[model samples]
Target: MITVITFNPSIDTLYKLETFEIGKVQRAGDVKKSAGGKGINVARVLNQLGHSPMCMGFVGGYNGLYIKDEIKKIGLRDEFIKIDGETRVCLNIIDKNKVSTEILESGPIVEENDMIKFERHLENILEETKILVASGSLPKGLPIDYYGLLGEICRIKNIKFILDTSGKYLESAINSHIYMIKPNIDELEALCKCNINNKEDAIKEAYKLLRYNIENICISMGKDGMILVNKDSIYEIKIPNIKIENTVGSGDSSIAGFAYGLLNDYSLKDCLRLSNACGMSNAMNIKTGFIDVNEIEKLFKEIEVLEYSKI
Candidate 1:
């Protein structure tokens, strides 16, 4: 089983409107609310794909309970750390055109001692873990290097670690013994300290990440597909694009697909295929982090993985 960690989970409210006008009251036609966090999003997708994922994170107050219930409602096996502060709530407003606007909240405040307790909780579950995924932002009072510490523990336990975060959190964990990471192209550019204007630069810069001891790096470009970087081989994966209902959680879906691939010991080429297929299928539906098995099967057949050339 894969383990997912969400430092700051929330209640995500998606409001659908015909059109949103500035300074005017808008009525939503349909509204949906559920658990929202980078890691939690991946967990939901994993459950949908018939995988058992154990989710761990911080939640408190009534909203926290609501988040827990929503996780169970979606059939995600979960174990959350209860805190004193109320969990956050985030808003996503989608217009008829499928354009989305978001309002996000910073989640519960966690004391330093509480972080220790979380690590202890993690200890009890590590034996069941095949891969450990820690995603999203750092909660209040928790150190940025917390993810790095997680990497350290995973290394000692011989479990693969996959990190998907940004800024200081990414910086701190970049040098850890991570099995893989799914940083979008922009994040990739920043990490490599150079702009990736073409395929050559994309491959070259991605290889630079291996210097930090990262075993694999997947840089996803929305329409251009994704680039895979490794020590022995490099490949570029491109897929047919479909009309996008919503782009939210597509990245998380890709992460879950890749993790699922690694857990099953699929070849790198096959893993990239699964990742691209899952990501593309997510855009085919209105629900975030969701995919139609039929959509995934069709897209999986259309994926093309090519060797790169500097020429």
Candidate 2:
């Protein structure tokens, strides 16, 4: 079974407006809410694609209950640790031009007891998990080594682990020698503290992670597609052109595709192709936690994979 862990979860409220007038009375044409967090989004996409991923994370208060109820309504299985403080609510305003403006609140503080409950939940889920994906930001009061520790636990339990996060959490997880990591160009640049101008540069930076004994690395470049680096070869995938309605949760979808492929024993190239397809498919939707399986299959064929010598 695939398991996804999100330390910071939220109820994502999306508002659509024909025109977002600043400092004026603006009315929304449409409003929707979804259970959101990077890992939860991944699990949602995986569930839509016929994979029932177990979502494990921290949730609390009324907002947290809403998140749990929404997850159940979507028919996804989850085991979240309840905390004292309320989970956050994130606002995404979509303008007429299809651009999204986000106002995200910092998540509630998780006390030591909350951390203990989370660890217990993680331990229980790891027993049957074949693939574990740790995604998103760490909540306040949690150490940066949170993901790193989870990565270590996965390694010890002999489960393949995929990490999708940024900043110190991702930095620490890199040192934990995860099985795979999917970081966009910006996140990669931030990790290596340098510019990744092209596929070659990305491959170069990805190779550095090999020193940490990480098995595979995927660098996603929006519109430009993605690059996959491993010990044997580098695969450059170019996604077919499509009109993008939204970019939110695309990365999480990509991680879901990759994890799903791995869990199903797909070849590395096929996994990367499917990952890119899922990302592009999510881009066609205007809402988070939304995916079109038919679009994913169509885009799957449109993805071209180029193999290169490992730098």
Candidate 3:
């Protein structure tokens, strides 16, 4: 079983408008809401792919209740820790031209006792968990090396830990025996402190991460697909472009796809193929972290995973 841990979860509210002006009253053409956070998105996509992932995180108040109900509605096991503080609400306003303006909340502060409860809960789940995924940012009041602690625990359990986060959190977990990390081009550039102008550059920068003890580094390049690097081989994955509706959660969907492939014992090339297809499929949908299996199947065949060393 795969387990997903989202430290800070939220109710994502999306608004679609013809135009958004600063300091003006604007009417929205459409509105949507869903249970959100990086890890929750991954769990949603995993559930969509027929994987019953155990969703663990902190949630509280009415919005938290909504998240719990939504998780259950989607047939995922809900293991969220109840807290006193309310869950946050993140707003994404998309204009007619497909430009997104975001307003994100810092989320509720988690106390030390909350982390204690979470660790206890996580310990109980590791026996049944094969892959442990910890995504998103740490809520306020938690230490920066929180993910590193989780990685160490997963390391002792022999479970594959796939981390999807950025900045200091990503850096903290680099040497903790992580099985994989999925960072986009911008994040990769920030981490490696170099500009990646092309696929070759992405491959080279990704190689720098191998020394951190990360077994697999998947660098997403948006429309250019992604580059996957391991100790022995490098693969350049290419995906056919389609009409994009919303790009949020595409990375989480990719992580879910790769985790699914790993759980099913797929080859590395096939794993990258599914991962890229899932990300591409997410872009074609309005809902975040969602994909139609038919769409994924179609995109899967179109995805090209080339062994870079042989090119």
Q: Pick the candidate with the highest lDDT.
A: 3
In order, the Cα lDDT scores of the candidates are: 0.86, 0.88, 0.91
Ranking by lDDT, best first? 3, 2, 1
Which window of ten consecutive residues has the lowest lDDT sum in model 1?
A: 302-311
Evaluation by lDDT, superior candidate among 2 and 3: 3
Q: Candidate 2's residue-wise lDDT over 1-311, tens digit each? A: 99888889999999999988789998999998889988999999999889988888889899999988988887888688888889999999999899799989989998988898788777888888999998889998798788888878877899998989988888877878699888888899999999878877888999998888789888889999988888988898998899988899999999999998999999888999889999988888987867898998888888999998866
Measured over all alpha carbons after superposition, the RMSD of each candidate to the real structure, in angstroms, is 1.6, 1.1, 1.3
lDDT tens digits by residue: candidate 1, 22-138: 899989899988888889989988887789799998999999999899898878887898889999999989999988999999877898777888889999999899899998999
Backbone clashes counted, model 1: 0
Q: How accurate is candidate 1 locally (lDDT)?
A: 0.86
Using alpha carbons, what is the TM-score of model 2?
A: 0.97
